[model samples]
Target: MKLTESNALARVAAYCSKAERCEYDVRKKLLGWELTEEEQQRIIERLRKEKFLDERRFVQSFVKDKIRFNKWGKAKISFELRKKKIPADIINECLGELDESELDESLRKILETKNKSIKAQNDYERKTKLIRFALSRGFSMDQVLKTLTGIIGNTDEEYF
Candidate 1:
């Protein structure tokens, strides 16, 4: 059944309070609730003015959580945020806010994980697989290649 506008607002408020959310996600939810575009915009404006919806804040929190808890690199997190319609300036700002040391560590850990999963391959094949995996995870080619080289150069052990 189609809910009244007030009911939808209350429900969305309850949903958003549980976690940080992006405007794109909230828009999708409003559509799911069968709200008209005009009504959706009205509620969104109200939310924005009241500080319930802040794009910059959402991008910042989203990037932090994805990196910290999910171990995602900036490329991956940035892509997701872009898909949410966040501005490039804000996206760049949040990415710039990421610690370089933490980013390097996250890349190293992902490389290690990929290495473990593809241990039976030859050197050429191994590198190919690792690069592909990291690419799929949205890591940059240069970072993946450099780290892969470093890891392989330091290891004398054969693949499993």
Candidate 2:
């Protein structure tokens, strides 16, 4: 069923009102509805004017949710936001606002939980597994290493 312009606009507006949405998300929805480029543009403009669509707000909400709920690192969050067509500058500014200590704490907790489940023959293997897990979750090697040191202890042992 093809939706007329006004119906599409109302549906999109209601969608945006339910939760924050970026332009890319709205554009995708409009495109799926098979609206013409001009119609998509006009609807987008109206959404912006009425404050139903806001990229910055979307980015901020995304960052907060990803950090708190997903326990994701900066690299993963930044990559996801970029994928959503958010501006790099906005991503940087929002990520920069995160507390370094808080991020470290989040990493620490994640490693602690993971450490309990990992079974290894030796400390080296355990450390290796932990590092790989954290890295896969988008954490930097440096931060993972630092946090692991405190959790795993035995810092003198060489782990490659």
| Model 2 error, position 109 (Å) | 1.0
Residue 72 accuracy (lDDT) in model 1: 79
Over 1-160, each residue of candidate 2 has an lDDT whose tens digit, in order, gives 5788999999999999999999999998998899999999999999999999988889889988887889899999999998988999999999999888878888999999999999999888888999889987778998998898799775554456
Itemize residue pairs with steric clashes in candidate 1.
Answer: none
Q: Compared with the true structure, what per-residue lDDT tens digits does model 1 show for residues 1-160?
A: 4777888887777767787777898899899889888888887887777777889988989887887788777788988888889999999987987787787777789888878888654777777787778777767877777777678763323421
Clashes of each: 0, 0
TM for every model, in the order presented, reads: 0.86, 0.95
Error of 1 at 29 (Å): 1.4
